[model samples]
Target: MSQQSVIQIALIEDDEIVRLAISQRLQLAGYDVIECADGESALSLIPTGFPGIVISDVRLPDISGLALLPQLLANNPEMPVILMTGHGDINMAVNALRDGAFDFLEKPFDPDKLIETVGCAIEKRQLQLGANKREEYLQQAQGLDQILIGSSPGMVELRQQLVKIANIDTNVIIYGDTGCGKELVADCLHKVSTRSQGNFVALNCAAIPEALFESELFGHEAGAFTGAIKKRIGKLEYADKGTLFLDEIESMPLNMQIKMLRILQEKLIVRVGGNKSIAIDVRVIAAAKESLKDNQGFRQDLFYRLNVAQLYLPPLRERGEDILLLFEHYVNLANIHAKPLSGLDEKTLLAYGWPGNVRELINVATRFGLDASLTVADILVTKPLASIDSSASELSLAMQTQNFERKVIAEALRTHKGSIIEVMDILDLPRRTLNQKMQKYDLHRADYI
Candidate 1:
């Protein structure tokens, strides 16, 4: 490799002869090698975000390579660490790999094989760095305040869709489970739109009383109603040339839905106790936790009008490793002293299905920051499952199969205690296939342990 493209390798070994041999071979292969006699020296020299991989002997004079693996991973989760072990300690090497070591090599290993493995690791690291740079560029362009904290495929696609629709004038309907940040997404839409200069009026339909729904939404002239002492501007008029976010639209009374639909259709509103028609230019973004389709309470015509552009926010459970990313973000925001997650904490975070989504995660993170001694159980407030009939016949064959698969995998993970190799052996699954299933089911090995 050219000097600029040369990959760096941190070589950690106590044996001077062995370290020299490895470093010479790596250097000959056009790699820049940093040699350390022990884990202590390596830790001092190799800072976090070290632009390279590590090659360490399992048995070190000061600290074992297996023990050092966690520190390296905690510094840079994407950094690859390759461990070297003797023939008799192959099991220990495998255990290290299970504990997050990138790969392991046997004693007296072929130089060419070592070179090939290192080359592959370097390529993977380069790709990850490129992706990180691209994400940073996008964050700068879009403004970091408006960026969402996630790297999952769903989140990536969601950001792209938001950018695509930001400049358009179409009305948007956001559908998501409770506490899934539907309002946050709506705010982002307004911030990125042409009407960012205008006020963003937000109202929860369910919070308003049935008798005052009209006055609250469309405003009223003084003395229009029993409590109308002064002329008041409605949410619609207040949001003129801006955005109106209607939260929990499914809870709006049926009668009010008709008036709301008329206002949207006419682009005009006539305040109560007034005959003059006022034209308004406002973008509507509605959010609901429940589906509006086939609901007798919701008007189908109004639903059709507002559903011109729909955005579905995925729940936190389906967001994979984003759970950890978001937790760290909250921890930083809380400004509490916290250590990197490992062992049982890692597993607990990955395994729990966050029914309350992002809102619940933030609360847990806040608690974690405040109480240093808090355990995973202390943070997890498990929600009870909805009652299900004890009849297997009620479920389709495909649903039954999927449930069985999830159960078996979960059981294997529990038995193995987060050991990937053990779980793979027990389930008789290839590594790639097991990973795919785990991702599909939102399962994490760390969570199980």
Candidate 2:
């Protein structure tokens, strides 16, 4: 790119020779100059594309240069304004400085000093923009919207299921590995549900200590436990008529499971030390990393009750092309926090097999923003991509090989950009096996196309 296409600076000066000289100096220093002879012309350009710094002569033909300083600063608080004054107007320049002018340059100033002051102004402007971008990222991160950012078939199906399930009050059990966005799915269910107007209360079953789990879930009356100086309301009572998301439900102890089952059956809760059973109308959304068959500690009866409606969240690697969509979303988010938003090269993206899922994607993107000088290799060196051939041989050599074959076929579909029939033809697999593999790998052709 040309030097003029890069840095943009606005210069407001009345004298023809002086304005041309300064603009030429800036242009030679690798800045795109916007020359405005008077305050009126500069005011007109402000709304279109505001410059990073304003260099205005104190005495202008159209407007008092001093008056324009405050107006420019008011419109763009982050913009730096450097005043240009004649030798006798030193006191005027001093007053302008107190009024928030970045600096004042007396006429016949040194060329090096002018360049140095402008450099400082531009750096300050960039710093301010960086801060604003960080704030925007935090807001987007906290947003609880269904911005489905994956191109994987599993994600598409998961979203479709959510659309249907959100209308009913059936208990949902979401199963997924850690960092697979189980909580995000739970939030989506609550947000899209008919009871969205009601509260969404989430409790991590694994995070709470076993001793306080009962009191935390069921609350207590005044003078019940050691610290129960006043009557305390439980999450169930607090979430009455709303959705209560019980994350990591498999971590719930057997004793608590029995009590939870009783509460689910009776629709009422008995406090830790209180006899009065309070009635509650709440929907439960439970999540666990392990499947029901794999859960050794959880009660089977409770599992059946909660799994009335089930959602199995797939891992990041399982969602093939969806990775790009998520990468784009995160890069845009990072642009707000970083200077000069950078994009991902194909090699960088394809060389890393993300083990930590979506959470890991956010972490890497955040780091890239803070240090723009980093290249793809430096940023993603920790998570090296696993080889496809190694995975293929690791499959059990039996009927289970069929499962492995299907997975390889599904990956072929991903590599070929999701042509199901085309992939089947290329792999020479039967139509039946291809269909089975697609379902097994959660690879939907529609998403690829």
Candidate 3:
């Protein structure tokens, strides 16, 4: 790697001999090493953007390595922290791992093992930082005012794909679940294109009556029919030199599908009652909630014509942390000053499967903003107790027991601020057993502290 891209490692060990030895080893292995003699020094020296993994001894002179782990994580959760433990400190080392230590080394450990572990952690960190940078670049390219707001990998890919397709004047088919922002994607396509100055006409194929579909799409001449009192420009003509967004295109009447296919194929349309053909310079962007190929009612020829470009939008559940990100966005839009979500609130939000996708989340966020006394219960699909019951029922007995134990231990740790004695007393666990359980769940007392 170039010097600019070289990974930096923060080595924190109070023992001068061990610190120097490890630092030299890491440096020899092509890593830039920042050496600190104690936890307190490391805390000040290793800034949030340290850009590497931390290797520290558990028994630091000023503060225990366990104590410093949480502080480092709080600064940058993605920064890996490795712990070096001494003989008879296996439990502490294990506990460190549970508490979010990337990996642990039992001293008198092999130098090669340390180097190998550091290499793996560095690679992982680089990948994470690279992803973040890519997301940032895409966002900047798309502009802050862009409607698609997310940093998830899926969203990043979608934005890049949208930017590529936007410049091309071709029909696009968007496949997404209801409320997954299909219309927003279509609008973005129109805004970034050459036709941005022209009108962006949107019509829901499912919302229009079958009888009026012809007139609504292709327009009618004056006195062409019983109710045709005036010459009307239809959606297609209205979108001339711009873009037409057809939402729920799968619901269009079968007979009308032929006319749409003809207009797409010929780049011209005849009025509902008149024979004069008008050339259209409009780009069609169609969206469907389900796969058009699987829908028996949809014509195969029309599907192929409109699907010159396709974009598959992931649901809210699959978007990971974007759920909370979007929720905060909607809350801001609602003009509500809200505090950061509590742990329980965040957990509940992540657990629920948002069948209604982003639309449902928007509704909840709006309601949450409007209602001062709103709780997670007000927005979540299942009550807390019921959700727990449902989860427990899904797992095997052994897995359920372990899950409950983890929760209980975590709660105790949180309540007592990682005080081992207090947690042991509250949970009625022996010291050794408590340590074992903590390590198993990767629970760190320092986190609560």
Question: For candidate 1, what is the TM-score?
Answer: 0.61
* Pairwise lDDT winner, candidates 1 and 2: 1
lDDT, candidate 1, 92-178, per-residue tens: 865876898767888899998898778767765654564455346444544523357677788788777887888999899998888
- The reply for model 3, stretches above 4 Å from the true place, is 1-40, 48-145, 381-449
Q: How many residue pairs collide in each prediction? A: 2, 2, 1
- lDDT string for model 2 (189-282, tens) is 8988987888899999999999999889999898997889998888988888889999988889889999998888889998878998889988
TM-score rank order: 3, 1, 2
Q: Candidate 1: worst 10 consecutive residues by lDDT?
A: 387-396
Q: Please, what is the whole-model Cα lDDT of each candidate in the order they appear?
A: 0.78, 0.73, 0.79
Candidate 1 Cα deviation (angstroms), residue 367 = 0.8
In Å, residue 278's CA in model 1 sits off its true spot by 1.4
Residue 232, candidate 2: C-alpha displacement in angstroms: 1.3
Off by more than 4 A, model 2? 1-146, 337-344, 382-449
Residue pairs with clashing backbones, model 1: 347-446, 347-447
Candidate number that wins on lDDT, 2 or 3: 3
lDDT of 3 by residue, 185-292 (tens): 999889989999999999999999999999999999999999899999999999999999999999999999988998998989988889999999999999998989
